[model samples]
Structure formats: C-alpha cells, structure tokens
Target: MGLILTEDQLILRDMAKSFFDEKSPVERMRALRDSRDAVGFSRDLWKEMGELGWIGILFPESVGGADMGYGELGVVLGECGRVLAPEPFMSTVLLGGNAILLGGNEPLQKELLPDVCSGNRILSLAFQERGRFAPYAIETKAKRDGDHYTITGRKSFVLDGHVADQIVVAARTAGSSGEREGLSLFVVEADAPGLTIHRDDLVDGRNGAHLVLENVAVDGARVLGTVDAGADVLDAVFNRATVGLCAEMVGSFEEAFERTLEYLKTREQFGVKIGTFQALRHRIANLFAEMEFTRSIVRDAQTAIDEGRNDIAEATSAAKARCSEVAPLIAGEAVQMHGGIGMTDEEEIGLFFKRLKAAELSLGDAIFHRNRFAHLRGY
Candidate 1:
C-alpha cells in the first residue's frame, strides 16, 4: 500500500486547503462561538460544501455521493481542521452517515442519505453515554413491542444532537452494559415524542447535546442491520471515525506548528530573532519529525480502511495513539514558544491549543488506544 498521496489526491488536498483558507478561516469558528448560534454551524456554508460534492465524498454514486475512499475524505477533514471549521462532518458524515451506509437497509439508505449528501438534513450518533470513550458500554435499553421498539435511556456528548434530523442510537436489547452482544442500532427522529434534547456548548466552540429518551418509540423498520448484531456495525463506524479524527488532529497540530514557526522567524527576542536560538531550533526539529511521522501513520490507517486490510484495526489504533500523543506535545510547544500571547484568548494559537487538546481526547485517548493496540497484538 502506498503511504503517499497520489497525484489526484495531492490536487484534491491543495484544492481543499485553498478552499478552507478562503471560506472557513479560524475567525469563523470564533464568531460562531461568540454569537452562541443555535445551530452551531452555518447551514448555508454546509450546503455550499455539499454543492462542492464534499459532504458526499464517501457514499456510493447512486446516492448522490462522489463514491470516493477515506483518503479523499481525510484530505477534506485535514483542511477543515486547519481552519477549525465548525461544520458537522464528524457527526453527520463519519459517525452517523457511515452507520447507515454500513448497516442500514436499502430503503433507509435511500430515505436519508440523499438528503445528507445535499446538506438538507443533519445526522448524529447518540452512542456515547459516559464521560469517556467506550463503544460497547451502552446501557440505553430498547425494548421491543409488536412492531416497534421503546427506547429508554440517556446519551451524553451527542455531537450536534440538538439539530440532527435523524439520530442513529445504540441501545441494548439483551446483554448488559459492557457486553458486545445483544446491542442494536436504530434511527430515531429528532422530534420523536418522549425525546428531550439539551444543547451543550463545547469548550472548542463546537456543539454537543444530551438526550433523554423516555419511552421514545421507533418503528422496527428503522433498525439498521440485524436485531441483535449491531456491534459489528458500531465497531466498523468507530474505527472509521477514529481514523478520521486522527486525520483532523494531524491538520490541527500541523497548523499550530507552522504558525509557531512563523512566530519564531518574525518575533524578536533580545534584539535578535528567536529562530537563531539553538535550543528552540532543536525543539522545532523534534516537533517537525513527530508531525511527519503522525502524517504517515494516519495515511496508512486511511489506506487500510480503503483497502479493506485485515490489519485495519491495528493501523487505526496506532494512528490514533500516535496522534493523541503528538498533538498535545505540539500544541503545548506552540503555546510555550508563543510565550504570553498564546495564553490569551485573542491569540490564534490558543484556539489551536484548545482544539488539539479536545482532539487528543476524542475517539480514544492515548492510553486507551495503547491498551487496545496491545490487546489486538496478543500482548
């Protein structure tokens, strides 16, 4: 498998980079946060992105998607990270849309995916229940009636949940919490009765929601895949999302490092450019090396998902673990190198700093992925 981006992929990357630079600059995220926008993102910009065919990069052509691979999708995500784009690619595309694409029946796919591709609808995955990342530790119960299921439970950290038109929920049908079996996936409408959504403002200027499903009923037709075998789908979606998130973190830290480099060149200290200092140069060199290594591993993970390799799980874990570790190091160094300015909210580096910290903990943190990687390797 090739580790480098192909010629076409490089073109796509450059195009996306320029596009985000022009349209979704860092200030856009800051503005969205300060305004306390209810939707938490610009719907018009999202639709423009859909018109550009980015929102549908991964879906099949029959569903109005570009029918591309994760490599292409990763390029877009990396660009989004550079500008701290506040759109819902993670919630609407990676986590929620992938669940439907991977497990939903044809009718379900046709029903929602086209709208998703056009940016007319929004989707989110309501799987996370606790503070940490645990895929199989679901406790939300989905009790079956004759032709429906009554879902009753709570979900926290539901990305963009308050505005999602449809939510893919993971509910336990038989097995207890922490077990892999007896789990199920269902697509519930946002306005469904007995479902209360509480909006939450994330530290990184992103949107989140807490959901309380008290006897929220969904038709059996909304079920994705088999009744008691949703873990298979959840595992696939989480792996893909983890790799995608690593791609975003790679872009975030890369931007942070680049900005720090610019500051070193221009900012003077003791009547001399700090770039001339040996100690800081050494730190820059080390961060550059680490960032390059992170890029390669993330590319490998993206390729593994595209090629359907047997080691996809290992590759994803390695990518996530490396990103989770390196992102903090790079963000911290960027802040330190920027000195007092970085600590203030007005400085752009602080924005990257906060984003990197959040990204480092997302999907699975460094320790969590390290343990997962070890177990997958039979250690």
Candidate 2:
C-alpha cells in the first residue's frame, strides 16, 4: 500500500485546502462558539459543500454520491481539521450515513441518502450512552409491538444531535448492555414525539447533544440491519470514523507544530530569537518527527480502508493509538513553547490544543486503542 498521495489525491487536497481556507476559517468556529449558534454550523455553507460534491464522497452514484473511497474523504477531513471547521462530516457522513449505506435496505438508502448527499438532511448516531466510548454498552431498549417499536433510554455525546434531521438510534432488542449480540439500529426523526434533545457546548468549542427518548415509536422499516445484529454495522462505522478522526488529528497537530515553529523563529527571548536556543530547537525537532510519523500512520490507515484490506481493524487501531499518543504530546509541547500566549483563547494555537485533546478522546484514547491493537493481533 502507498503512503504517499497520488497526483489526483494531491489535487483534491489542494482544492479542499483552498475551499476551507476561503469559506470556513478558524474565525467561523470561534464565531459559532461565541454566539452559541443554534445550528452550530451554517447550512448554507453545508449546501455549498454539497454542491461541490464534498458531502457525497462516500456514497454510491445511485444515491447522488460520487462513489469514492475513504482516501478522498480523508483528504477533505484533514483540510477541515486544519481550519477546525465545525461541519458534520463525522456525525453525518461517517457515522449515520455509513450505517444506512452499509446496513440499510435499498429503499431506506434511496429515501435518506439522497438528502444526505445534497446536504438537505443532517444525520447523527446515538450510540454512546455512557461516559466512555464503549460501542456495545447501550442501555436503550426498543420493544417491538407488531409493526412499530417503542424506544426508551438516554444518549450522551450524540455529535450534532441537536441539528440532525434523523438519528440512527442503537437500542438493545434482545441481549443486555455490554453484550455484542441483540443490538439493533433504528432511524428516528429528530422531531419525533417523546424525544428530548439537550444541546451541549463541548470543551473543544464543538456541539454535542444529549437525547432522552421516552417511549419513542419507530416503524419496523427504519431498522438499518437485522433485528439482533447491529454490532456489525457499528463496527464498520466506527472503523471508518476512527480512521477519519485520525486523519483530522494529523492535520491539527501538523498545523499546531508549524504555528509553534513559526513563533519560535519570530518570538524574541533575551533579545534574540527563541529558535536559536539549542534546547528549544531539539524539542521542536522531536515534535516534527512525531508529527511526520503520525501523518504516515494515518495515511496508511486511510489507504487500508480504500484498498479494502482484511486487516483494517489492525491498521485503524494502530493509527488511532499513534494519533492518540502524538496529538496530545504535540499540542502540549506547542502550548508550552508558546508560553503565556498559548494559554489564552485569543491565540489560534490554543484552539488547536483543545481540538487535538478532544480528538484524542473521541473514538478511543491511546491506552484503549493499544489494548484493542493487542487483542486484534491475537496477543
């Protein structure tokens, strides 16, 4: 597998970089956070992204998507990371949209994916019900009553859940929580009766919603896959989303490192540039090596997805573990090297620090992925 981007991928990266630089800068995220925007991100900007085919990269042509691979999508996500764009690529495209695409029946795909491709509908996955990232530890229960099911439970850390047009809810239809079997996925509308959504402003300046479902009713047709086998779908979705998040983390740390390096060159200490200090230079040199190593592993995971390798689980876990390790180190070093300025919200480097920390904990932290990597290797 190739770690380097092809000519076409490079062109796509350049185009996406230019688009994000022009349309969605760090200022946009700051503005959204400061105003506590109801929608968090701009739908008009999302529609523009749809018009440019950025939202449809993972979907098939039958659903108005570009029928592309994760490599292309990773490139766009990396650019989004560079600017900290508060878009729903992770919530909609990777989590919710992929769940439907990979597991849903054709009619459901035809009904929902088209709108998703056009950015007309936002989607989110309500899977995490606890404090950590346990995929199968779902307590939400769905009871089937003839043609409809009554769902009752709560979900936390539902990314973009406040604005999602539809939510892919994970409910236990058979087995108990923490068991891989007997889990089911159902598509529930955001405005459905008996459903409550509480919007939360995350530490990273992004938005997540906590949802409380009280006897929420869903038709049997909304089920994404088999009645008691949602873990399969969840596994596939999480793998891609984890790798995509790793790609974003790579971009974020790379940007933070560059900005810190620039500051070292310009900021003066003792009437001389701080970059001249041998100790500081050594630190930055180590940071650069870690950043490049992270970039390579992330690229390898993305390539594994695109190439449909059988060992995608191993590759993604490795990538996430490495990213989880390097991102915090880079962010911390960047902030420390910048001194007082990095501690404030007014500085851009601080934003990267927050985002990197959030990303590190998003899918799974370093220790979690390391254990997962070991298990996957049959150790």
lDDT of each: 0.94, 0.92
Q: How many backbone collisions does model 2 have?
A: 0
Tell me how candidate 2 scores on lDDT: 0.92
lDDT score for residue 318 of model 2:
94
What tens-digit string does per-residue lDDT give for candidate 1 at 1-379?
4898899889999999898888889999999999999889999999998998999999998899999989999999999999999899999999999999999999999999999999999999999899888888999999999999999999998999989999999999998999999999999999999999999988898988999999999999999988889999998998999998998898899999999999999999999999999999999999999999989999999999999999999999999999999999999999999999989999999999988888888788999999999999999
In candidate 2 the C-alpha lDDT for residue 253 amounts to 86
Clashes of each: 0, 0
TM-score of 1: 0.98
Q: C-alpha displacement of 43 in model 1, angstroms? A: 0.8
Model 2 agreement with the true structure over 1-379: per-residue lDDT tens digits = 4888888889999999999999888999999999989899999989998988989999999999999888888889889999999899989998999999988999999999999999999999999888777878999999999999999999999999999999999999998999999999999999999999999989998889999999999999999888999899989989999998998888788888889999999999899999999999999999888888888888889888889989899999999999999999999999999999999999999999998998999988999899999999999
